[model samples]
Target: MPGFDSEFTPITRQRLFAGERLRAIRRRAGLGQAAMAARLGISVSYLSQIENDDRPLTSAVLAALARHHPFDLAAIEADQPTRRFAAARAALDDPVFAGSALAADALARIVEQQPAFADRFIALHAAYRRAEERLQMVDEGLESGGGRLPWEEVRDWFHEAGNYVDLLDRGAESLALRLGDGDGALRDALAERGIVVATNDDPATLRRLDRADGRLAISAALPPESRRFMLAHQLAAIAFAEPIAAIAESAALRSAEARRLLAVGLANYAAGALLMPYERFRAAARAFRHDIDRLRLHFSVSFEQACHRLSTLQRPGARGVPMFFCRVDMAGNITKRHSATRLQFARFGGACPLWAVHEAVAIPDRIMTQLVETPDGVRYVSMAKGLVKASGSFARAPRRYAVALGCEAAHARDFVYADAIDVDGSGAATPIGISCRLCPRADCDQRAFPPADRAIAVDPDIRRIVPYRL
Candidate 1:
């Protein structure tokens, strides 16, 4: 009886890759061990040896040998590149460095150390490419898209995990450091660990550390807030890499490299949060009556940082104003958001044009307020404001945004930003949903992608304000 081989299996292919063919092919040829040994000019024991992978059929043996049976070398090599591609792909699967060359470089490095992780990356990439192709076809079938596009999977992974709060909490409790309001505390702590802190350059853009020079220059590009963030983040990474890596390694994550990177991100976020704990800042913020400008004075944190930290106060029963915070720039791009309350800032595409968050950038340094709601009747009082990162000296320095907060409409009276949004208006709250796929609103100009489930009707009789007829 002839034995049949499965289409694919890692071990089978790897064996053939390692040139283990003597056992099967010689047997199929009905050649006994001694005869096969004579034909290959090797000892009978040597023939047995190569078959068991105990000794290599070195290039010399392979060149002199010939298969006395039917087989297809081309068919066997067909899946070889796919195997290598899978490894290369696995090495590059990094969420932090997604959409950049960093992922590819990371993958190459992984190939040098752990090839299995790299192989998994390749398999995942192939699956992703196929899924995206199918999704595009689905979009084409819709003819046109309107409202928030259904990019739920991409959105949640990129936006939610990238938010840094969860990672911060995990890393902070593990470090067991005392967080206080003093600006010098972090620098002093790092110094105790032989880490010298200097205001040489912004930490993010500083490429490498010159061990010989004993100098740590910051990037002149960063704003004060970003400077503190990058510095604290790096310090945290140095302090907690081992423990964080341990957590990541044991996390049962899809990829091992992702676990390592998550450790870095988690460490950085923890460092920043440790420099500014929730309880202390929340208390100072209340004393100032949630006045962001004044809170920045008390704690050397930026408006956005102060505002963002405020939203994370999920302490039992002593909760603060349960606000939704957003940080945006002049172009209406929502750089980040931390929300405990329901404020629908588009997780994909552009935000609603009618919303004050988009308009706040235009009215620089002025607070823009609005009353918004989702279709299911969750109302919010949102405050949007622009933030200028660099002052007069640093003209080339980038601009940023600082939209302090929002909360349930019922709590609007306590916030100064909700002074005039008219939450009680009978008109529909401009239909907003999470991402385009989840949002069913038709013809919203803010939509970056069309809703996945929108039953868009086209009559051509009336022109919709949005570019798409959906």
Candidate 2:
């Protein structure tokens, strides 16, 4: 695996008023002030001062806590004043709070003194936003006279579930471990079950399994990585049938078509999990600093598969960096989308044309990188790669699409593509919106349409890049 070289620099050294977090940690560990102070090699009065917000937790105290406590130091660090301040600031960018947003100092003070209240407010705002988006999606479906499309229902099911299926992920990882041995592990496992695997070259379907005949065939049209993925998909269909059915049943989807689609999606997820088990893949990703090419090479999976798997590493207490992943076709349609970060994809139509993913779609086999700031002022480091899958014949058209993976700029350290971006440098990041109809940027030259919620005024006498004034 390839790794990047970097200078070790601290993101911040500001005074952290983490009294509430400190107290919570101590209480959770059932330790008194004196006991915790002793463990941290600090005076009881100093510890008391720190807990009471009179003094900040010094680097030495943080180090001591890390060395002595069994808790997640990273979690503790993440809950500090800086992160809270960022979250509160971002949440306040919502248009609903337009004129009544708090100042930076006041927000920081509130986060320091009443962290729980701040958290609840952010959570409430988030839920309200989700509701609004869902309503918008429903409105679009109704306008189309589709009455809530089954595929959209299935998409929302995955989106609401955070794109990380715990039961399927765990089951797949267990199966991967049990298969044992080297490169031929999957094939060996199938052989043990008296099944023969072969290449079909039919191109009609990706895979076909005749259970009664103990035979399985994968399309030769697919590349090697996709072939292996299909193999894992077949394995999941057999070994995880019950769990997949249970998950689909519990989803309470509106249509039988939706339930069937959910099952297929779950099976695909299980196949990815089996091909690249969670723990091993996450460890490798961290080690390589999330280099997509290296990850694909190491796991013998496709580029899109590596990126998709990276987006799903959201296990509790062992989460990977929060990321957003989407696949866009040449027509600008978002075929697959998931976000573990603050960024969300457009629910109904095409994505922002300014997004690098759209550009990637025109130029296959090359990776594109960009530093983009959303309309809400959140910056992200985005990486996109265009790919074409062969149909194994000149007459059959190939499949062309681009997959994008990104995380907040704050997580630039863990993302390989972010090395090209100067996180602290002064530059105007390319401004983008979720979608044309949802975007608030009135000045965007590439905006195909005005925001759906806002009224547009047309002046026949005057003309600009956009036809109407928003």
Candidate 3:
């Protein structure tokens, strides 16, 4: 009674009859016109008028029908001329429909006349996007001359799984509990299985596993964290052999090489999980407010390891703030990527240059933070730090990369990097796009290419920062 208004406003006067939706609902419910009219608390003649579009449905009748009948009101509302016309117009704006641009009235008429065709067009556009991504991957493989390499297949497999392997995670957590925490405990566990763990000063080999001789060799030149990670990776291979094999076999990869790479990836995932147990790490993350430095010190893991572990904190009931993690080399190639958030990385090219991750490359060891907004209007508080992994010799160059971690603005309160920034304030956020080619912004000077979905206009007399007007 409180929500239902007795007097209808002028806005309600525009109500058009959704006779088709009403008839469909009635037929699905298997109710005759008389019974439907009785249930809706309306006279049979009035119901017939509503069904035949001879009368518009009023507020009182709509409320009565909602109270008595089970129907999707949202679906019925979407059938309104205004909403349907808007959807059709948005679809027409797609680059696929570029050459055949229709006037607003024309598009609206099409939606009104052929709604099924419009819906199918939207579905076909979505399918086009999926196919485009696959094509990009194929092109990359061809450029590399490897014909879709095994490592790329494994990477795509992980991407499809949301970057979290539940079976491997749980198995690793159980193994960690049994082996206990700390490097000493891990060493003792390995030793008990007749696997002698020893470190060698030779920089040529990072890690070597001899199964027949039951010996594991690690490089002494490597740092404590790296050494520990390598040892844990080996332990995963030995301890969870059956589970890892089952997961690899179930993948049904085209080549044995891909399956082997997948097994290694699963082992690496297991090693990360073992190094930082989920519950303990999540609680510590909350306590530290997700400060990467403090987390690395507490867990005795490297900065990259800490960030990678944070991305995998997607357990069922207990979960951490969803974050996107990525590593970009000096060449701007994204070597690793995973997102538990809505933010998706560009599959083909480098990340947006305006992002803080690129800046981190110039300023090593310092963590850079920026509040960035995507083209879709979602804001993220991103943090990045440049790292150099020494090759332990002057003859070889150190591996240079910048690791980036971020979460959506909703999780800003939990992220330490967002502490200094005002996320809610206007004009304080940096506008970033998914990629230059896919971005819709026209005036961006940093844009390397024009948007694939939009038309460009070039004038010799009128030149701006960008040559073409989009």
Best by lDDT: 2
| C-alpha lDDT (0 to 100) for residue 85 of candidate 1 | 32
- RMSD, every candidate, angstroms: 23.0, 9.5, 13.3
TM-score of 3: 0.70
Instruction: Write one digit per residue (lDDT tens) for candidate 1, span 42-124.
Output: 78997787888776443223322312111111222224333343334322332323565433223323443455765676677
> Any runs in candidate 2 off by more than 4 Å, and if so which?
1-123, 139-146, 181-183
User: Model 3 segments beyond 4 Å from truth?
Assistant: 1-147
True-structure Cα RMSD, model 1: 23.0
Give the range where candidate 3 is weakest over 10 consecutive residues by summed lDDT: 1-10
Candidate lDDT scores, in order, read 0.54, 0.78, 0.76
Residue-level lDDT tens digits of model 3 in 192-289: 88898987777878999888998899987789999999989988888888989999999957899999999999999999999988878877887787
> Residue 328 of model 1: what lDDT?
67
For candidate 3, the C-alpha RMSD (Å) to the true structure equals 13.3
TM-score of each: 0.56, 0.78, 0.70
lDDT of the structure predicted as candidate 2: 0.78
By lDDT, is 2 or 3 better? 2
lDDT of 2 by residue, 1-470 (tens): 11111211112344456787788766644468888888777899988888898876654465455443322344556445544445556677665676795544455556666888988988998899888767667655654565657898898898889899999999999998898534378787778777789889798688888889998988888888888888788778778989999999989699889999999999999999998999899878877878999999998998999999999988865667778999999899899999987678877777888888999998999999999988767788999999998878888898899999998876665688988788666684788988777788889999787887799999999999899988
By TM-score, the best candidate is 2
TM-score of 2: 0.78
